[model samples]
Target: MDESRPTPATPPAVLADHAERMEKLLDRLLSPQTLCDEIARPERLRAAMAHGLLGGGKRLRPFLVEQSAALFHANTDAVLRVGAALECVHCYSLIHDDLPAMDDDDLRRGRPTVHRAFDEATAILAGDALLTLAFDIVSSDETDLPPTRKLALVAGLSRAAGIGGMVGGQMRDLEAEKTDRPLAIRDIEMLQSMKTGALLRYACEAGAIAAGASGDERARLRRFGEIVGLSFQLADDLLDLTSDTATTGKATGKDAAANKATLPSLHGIDWTTARLRDLVVEATDLLDPFGSKADILVQTARYIAFRDR
Candidate 1:
């Protein structure tokens, strides 16, 4: 059942198409009928959740999931569901991250943050709902995955999104910000990997799990995810340094203002750029086993490294 085929369109086009489809899917998934019984979903809460979730993004993590799954010819419908679940977690993180307690940002994806648009209590509830909904989507029968695979996906996502991963990383970042001394390179790496890289890594790993890929293949994709995750953070730091809010659709220069220890900040712009190129080369090399079937992922790695926003 290998669904791999020659794609005539360029990589960016493929990514755009994927993003469009994912947007539509999310719109439907967040609707009243699809989320829960009508009586259980409160009006304002649903609106807040939609405001946060429907906000525009590149949808890069889900693209990673879908492309990774394609390498193994996994079921299209099932993988899309998995991608949606991952996106729920991603959006949830953004909502909570923008709260007054966290980064305290006023804007997200070119719109007012959920907490700013709605009350803080409602924003908190929306984030919690999205996080919980991600698990429900993966574990529910609608995913079209076997029980064992579903369990594995749930476990992987929880670890990536929970403490000892993203949450732990966030704690470290907050602590680092409080101190006058800057974090060491190793400490910053660990923080970034956990906070920003965990779910992205899981995005690739989850695809392999859904496809029943061999351990070696799974491990390779996991490593690729790790590299891409690092590159992603580096690029983000660069954008924060160089781009404006108008271009990035979010606040810029917050990292330096907060004294955050990002690789681009630690190393100069030239060094960070070189490192990003190296990471992309390394990531694409890992996919050589899949040949042209992995072209989209290869392009995705480059995009992650060089994206303006």
Candidate 2:
């Protein structure tokens, strides 16, 4: 769902600000004119893409990309564009995930899912267009990065979004549902790391690529990304157990309904929440070398762990 403005209680100043900026930028990016406006652009397809992309969500993946690049003082434009590309992939995944063949949900971001708003075929086509558009945007000359960096971003994104990463994990998730065996903790971790963690991990690495960060620096960021993916998975599983559909802005309790194995189902909410807290500390500590420069990321980690939705 769209990020709720931070209150005195949450105090995620950096996240609140970043989320606002990403939303405004994305509004323009998904507009018809930006998406190759043409008399033949097919208004209905464009509309479906817009509905999927412009709808409410945290935009956290983009924020992570941009913030990570900020650590290396990378170009602002390049950072934002990289973040935008990642968001396209993320939004496209959601469009497909909510389809009848996937999660089979009627609601997403507090409104009808793309399939419900339009039709299944339109939703599928829109998702394909958006996913392809992401690569196009990342590789555009307008991104102003070197050929080497652009290639790195392209190759990395392909792997993250493709069979070795997100797709592989999704297939595993489907298999988990079909089998009679209960998923072990390791199984859930492996499943979640791929299904949810791949894009998140790529977001950080993309930032490093944007800045031409040193191998040591990139490695550190990559590890940080891994931690983030796991942390986000735990928090999400917790939300599934505790939050209502309205609060989450999407269907809740679907995991149990679908018999999908989630970490929270194996470990109760109290334990999962506690693990999330520990992860917050570990994530921040990983940034100690950067000190105050990493404060925003530290707070972002805390927000991810504690968000109500």
Candidate 1, residues 153-200: lDDT per residue as tens digits? 999999999998988988888888789998999999999999999989
> TM-scores of all models?
0.93, 0.91
Q: Summarize candidate 2's per-residue lDDT along 1-309 as a digit string, tens digits.
A: 323222212535666677788888778877777778587688898899889988567788888888888888884887898898999998898899888997788988678999999999999999999899999989998889989998999999999999888888988887887798778889888888898999998998889888899888888888888888998888787778878988877678877876777887887876776687678788888889888888888887777777777
Clashing pairs in 1: none
Weakest 10 consecutive residues of candidate 2 by summed lDDT: 1-10
Highest-TM-score candidate: 1
Q: How many backbone clashes does candidate 2 have?
A: 2
Question: Lowest-lDDT window of 10 residues in candidate 1?
Answer: 1-10
RMSD of each: 5.5, 4.1
